[model samples]
Target: MKSIDVLLAVLANGWVVSAVLWKDSISRNTTDILRKRYRDEKTQKFSTVFNSRKPSLTSNPASKPFYITLPLDHFTTSNTDTFQSRYYVQDSYYQPGGPVIFHDIGESSIERYAPGLVDEEEFTVSMAKRFNGLLILFEHRFYGESAPLTEVSRALGDASKEGLTAFFKYLTIEQALEDVVVFANNFTYDFQSYPSQKLTPEYTPWVYVGVSYSGARGAWLAKRNPGLFKATLASSAPVELKVDFWEYFVAIEANLAASGNTNCSADLAAAAAWLSQAWETQNETLVDKLIDTVYQADWENYISQFRNQDDPRIWDTRRDYMQDAAWTAFADFQYYGVQGGTLGKFCDIMETAYSDNAPAEGLFATESLDRAVAGYTKAVAAINPYSYSRSARNKAKLKQKRQSSKLDSSLDDYAWLWQVCSEFGAFQVANTSRPQNMLPSFINVAAQIDQCIGTFGESDQVSLAGPNVSPINQKYLGWNIELSNTLWTNGEFDPWRALSIDSTTEDAPTNDTSTTEIPQCGTTFPRGTQLRYVIVDGYHGSEFSEDVVENADDIGLNPTNTIGGISASRRVTLTSTGTGTPVADARNAQSLWFNAMSTWLPCGTQVFTFTSPQPSSSTPFKTRSSYSTDGPSTDGSTTEGLTTDGSTTSNPSRQSSSPSENKTQSAASLVLPPLMNLFMLSLFAFLTGVGFIL
Candidate 1:
């Protein structure tokens, strides 16, 4: 009865039962599971759009580039109130690959990247090729093609009855970041939807790299959207979260000392003293001459008067040297050397008062000496407001006026003296001013100087303005803190707006251990988060040495490929490893040091090192690394194998047969015994089934 019922059910539902049973068997099959897993693995391997494409080289690639323009603080109702932002992209060379994009972050001044200065297009191309990605360059919100929105709004009376005050408050750093993100999203989507030349199939990962001011923006974007950018590189950045004027003044002072200007220091002091005294005497003619001198002093004359004072023949030598184009070039090179960070020897040459080996040239020529005296006299006279006051001649009134004028003059002299000292590096500027003032000034000046010097010369300068300019601290408070953090926290080589003061006392600890102690008055110390500091003994922005560049290659970075390679003579190292043979088994440690040094060694002579457990008789291995050339010492080794080469040390306990032995065994196992047995079993089962069927 049961067999008859089963047969009837199978005959009626054969197709349905077969379909359901087959589907269930397929779902449970190992082959099917393996196939699904393989597909998932493939997808994961190509997850990043950037890695999806194949490498190719083409002189004239057939692809049209797409561009996006963003408006920051654009006023809808007024033409004057609009600011511009721009970004560019190109499709990937590989099909179904991600697109590449580049962004150019603008610096602070309106005159930045002008016709005579650094070529923007060249810079863009170099950076694009260096990163092996698409490029995007945009003017800052208030500069260049971008409009000064606040100024424009005020001019157009965009604000309500609240007047210009309300309209003037339109620009801020956060708004700048928002503008960048918006432009990026819109541009990336547009490229993905309708590529310029159909080279790239979809949007790809983005990378942002910036120098000086724009470095601040790149850092801001990276920190704000870590997931967005695969990586970010910022150079010569000043990333102080808060503004402090005194901090900047302090930096200037430090720069002055760094300049290696011996005569300038003493001269500046004397000039200040002279002005203060003259102000008390109400000297008018001297004040006017001093102002005129500031405008007329050429680079050579200035250097001679300040740094090369002891050399009686220095001015003549410079004049003679400048007569020949080759000599002029040599002088320019020397000047750049001083500016770059080669101040020790340069200062020695100029230190006539301290050294017996003085050059024949006097610090200043006769004409220059005359000019300086006149300028000093003029500056002194200008301090006296009463010098211009001819009507009040009463004895008592005259005395009171003279005293007041003297005090004002003295203050002005002090200010100018501090500026000169900071400019030439007589003392650390941070030690001269209060931190509140120091911070903002440091941020503004440091940012400006780095941008200008990095691209142009100290001779070329630019101006910045806004209603919020004064009390710079208040104005900078509006800047994005994220940008600040990104700038300061990344590399010690990079400078931020934070005030950095030198220790006044020799006994003062190097580390910032006094967490709760507020810096003293007139000290330009940084507050808030303590910065990780590394002092490199070389010129600012000097190229790293070839050896350092070679070392960098070990760490997977080629600084030469990125920045025109370093000069062969420059010595740059990450550690304090002096030139010598190892005292013990330091070979591996040295190799590790070489790898670690490459990561952050700027284009110059550099050495790097790491700290590890010293080798002992019991351990017999000193697992450490260290190196140094022309810069500060660094640590780049870890306990878990060497992080430099992306490899781990083998465990001492684990032992395995060599590849040859394993291969011999694997080859022998490729015999027919297992196959023969399986075949015989299958054949017997098949015969038994046949017999049953018969």
Candidate 2:
């Protein structure tokens, strides 16, 4: 599934990159599940057939890109510097007085496929149409053409430290969020081609929607600037920022075992143990054997060339680099979960594709670890998971990435890395704390910091102490936060779930509502009441890929592609009215999302009315068939905590009334309607799709 997804992405990108481009494809950005998973590095060769099929960004003039000048620093008066930040408007479904639904293209270039995201059938686009609102996709600062300092190279070893610092100094979540508000304050659009639903918070209502990191921003924005946004729908928002973040492996290990990709978790664990032993003990003979077995490269010759060329191992040169390379198959799980688990493809090979040298059976003088290594070696050789080979182009590109000092994205990476080095201390280190860990024990936060310091001028300053995630968490209130008029969702099997409200590995514990904790979050939501949901078997941002449910077979989804051979995509096709199917559960959740929004959104009339609809304490699945609401009212404030605020309660227990649904109103299940054609065309554009391949 990983390779196929990669192939589709590569095909969608319309350019066959030199084989080495995959190195650039693996992003070590803040949101590991979104960026490297869906979109990757760009090239102009290797693949030309698919390029012809890609839709042009100009195909829809209504969604054509737009830009506005934004101050480099909104929090400080340090400089009056400004940059042109790019945005796109898909107002086909918008009315003159409708609300504007802003989608933050968080940390990626919207210039790719974002400008073409005008299709009425898109999940976000569909929401805009449903609410008669304008859909705006705003690119985050320091990404795409939104960079404040363009000509300034952002390379880690930037020639001018001032240039590197100056370029990234202004990029903070606070500043980016401010950019949205600032843009809205003086917002104007001349859609001679289309009527602008242009108005500020004083006269118009605004809504925020995003997935992954952008989703976190939605939650934060709703909390900080309600005057600017009335409602927020955050999907897979990892509000908690932890430096260790070993729970990442916890979720991955748990999910792999649960979904019937049997032996995958255990096999990888054994492999990690052996890899750690061989690398750390300086077992040269074993290292050579493993390298020859896994990568099929001549270890001695490769080493000679590596020394001569001074190539940068994409992850790090310190430990066995393949330790990082081993999991590329699984990193894109969220990206492929809509189709099926990305691990599904890799596991099939792991379970079946044995290389010639792989042992036919357990042999004498060998422990079980030997068989595990053989299996892994065979799997890696068969999968060619990294797209890395000892070709001249591959080695050359590796050297090129290291020697190049431009931070402005020769491959467009350093921007996100800056954020990771800034406030998002989500270092995906090995969980040595756990009794059973899946990653090589050698990978630690210190190594990460060393690289950051070695590359950029400074680390997050955490050395061995790990990053002080408190800076972002304390400010945002982490999972301790509660927002009225906001909806939160997560994928049950997503590795990122470890970082979300559904987390259970200690850092922060939740006394859930299904059991009776008061406000149910993450696990369950009451109809017409609570706004949190955990999609059973769902992956990161799976909500946006709703179209996959309708076209499962058309796109070659097999029934056995998911857990225990249960096609995950098939679960989305189960009737949309019940909790039995993954799709059904998600749609039903979205139904509540609609019901809540209908009552919350005061565009014109009361669509569905609801009372102070408090969900039962804990993760209880209570259902209410009917609801009623009074029309939305305005306090008439022009700034912070705007009119039509739907936030009903906070954790500290703020008293705000919520609406009730007259009936269980479900959002219309999505239909592709030629949308996939456009979706694939712009598939290369969701720049930051999943998280780090590292």
Candidate 3:
């Protein structure tokens, strides 16, 4: 049954695009999932309906891209003084007195795709409309077209080299944060001198939004400069960076176990044990022999089959860097969980193949195992988010030099790897002590350290296992750091969630002032920084994706995808109520996010509304749903309605009191159309047909 679900999801969704883009893959930032996924599925064309509502800033008449001059070395005045940094502004929602939302682009290329926070009519845009706020998207310093160095002659060498090392020094997260600040200062209030004269030149409240790595930046921005950002909405931000991230596998195993697939878990564990034993032997020949024998294929050929590049093994040691590819495949499935348990599907296959009484043609069979391994390898290889290949890095560099580039996206993979090697040691290594360990011991902390040494030279200050890691922890406040008005969220199943702060974590910065204890998922932590764990079944960044209703086939989702541990903040599809209110189904993440947004920026009417009529009050107040209100149903649907003030409205209010004298009853409620019911029903049917029933 699990295998069937997996097949259906893969067939329906084509591939886990976001998982391939941002999740654990070979070379984390190598692929740009957004571009590749869209190319395969939606082609280069975006949703025309969506494009009409929130056009790209570059395409909009009221919007334009701007390049601001920034210091190459922000700290040293003697160094090269300036480099051009890129940013975009959309003034369609700008109101002289309104707020602004600053969207932080992640480590990927932003200009390659159109930008909008929430979908066509979702929460972010809805809030923009409600507050009449301006929306701005800023590309990080080294990503997209924001290139400090136009060309690089060398791929690997000393820091004094005029290529990678010289350019990478300016690509720090702190510099990127400053780039946004400079852009904000120039655009937000410097109106007379700025490109957009239509916008006001006054201080306005600003909100920050980011996902994954950028999400952590947003929180850090709010933390370090609280007055700059009014509030931040961060989804799946691993603010705490750890060097030896064995907990990554721990999360994977726990999530797999949550699926209730005992046999699947057992088989996968057996495979892990076998692989670990091979690594423990420390014999390259023995390891290669075991791999070829078990899977009935040569390790080098199978690993290189996808990328078409030679094996990633270092010439100095026979250790195959591509050995992590199989583990990555399993890890991605657990992290993605797109159609509810992608990992479960892989496990089911393993269980079948490793069964004691398996047939001759099964995975254990010499001939069949070879075929199965090769097929799986090919599928895993196709998971790239970026258009170019690792083999094309040099080609891209040479091409950049030959052309007048508006935006050099070739720096993405190189820049991201530099960040990981320099600061954030988020290496996904194995913890063999765990009972459910699935990754080989060779993919250990030392291997990753060696990788950094190979990429960034031996003299590089990147030894987290050695004496150099303490400064990074001290500078970032490690896991114990605290900040106010920032929400830190992580998916319960996300392998990266292990690095994030949670209830059981004891590494929180000692300087944290908040008294709130981080709670397990589905609970509230009101004392300190806002922390949310999406425990109700989701993969990495699932909360950040737009919550729109689509056909099961379109999204590779089935009705059964909602089955998992229940949490207060879980999203589930509810049965339609025949009424055309378009409020039957709602996303718990969106609901919670909007609710938090209202609290942070409370100057306007709440973004959404849902409430029961006052108990026969003498002053009859009009009961009208707000523009963003999509109330939960009383018929036991999964949708949770929002109150007038952005509070979760699950059950209708039973408060017994007279209506407030200040409240005005809506005229629409007082004089209803004769065919109101029919009109609503028709509207609902129309919305359902057009896939807008969120």
Off by over 4 Å in 2: 1-63, 154-162, 193-197, 292-302, 306-320, 337-339, 353-371, 386-407, 459-466, 512-530, 548-584, 603-694
Worst window of 10 by summed lDDT in candidate 2:
43-52
Tell me, by TM-score, which candidate is best.
2
Tell me each candidate's TM-score: 0.39, 0.67, 0.62
lDDT scores of the candidates, listed in order: 0.27, 0.49, 0.44
The candidates, ranked best first by TM-score, are: 2, 3, 1
- lDDT by residue (133-179, candidate 1, tens digit) is 45544444533224332332222211222332232233344445556
- C-alpha positional error of residue 302 in candidate 2 after TM-score superposition, expressed in Å: 4.5
Model 2, 67: alpha-carbon shift in Å? Answer: 0.9
- Which residue segments of model 1 deviate by more than 4 Å? 1-83, 87-103, 108-127, 148-168, 188-203, 241-243, 249-260, 272-282, 292-694
lDDT of 2 at 259: 65
lDDT of 3 at 501: 59
- Candidate 3 lowest-lDDT run of ten: 654-663
Which consecutive 10 residues in model 1 have the weakest lDDT in total?
29-38
Clashing pairs in 3: 31-385, 31-386, 32-385, 32-386, 33-385, 145-407, 480-508, 480-509, 481-509, 622-665
In what order do the candidates fall by lDDT, top score first? 2, 3, 1
Better of 1 and 2 by TM-score: 2
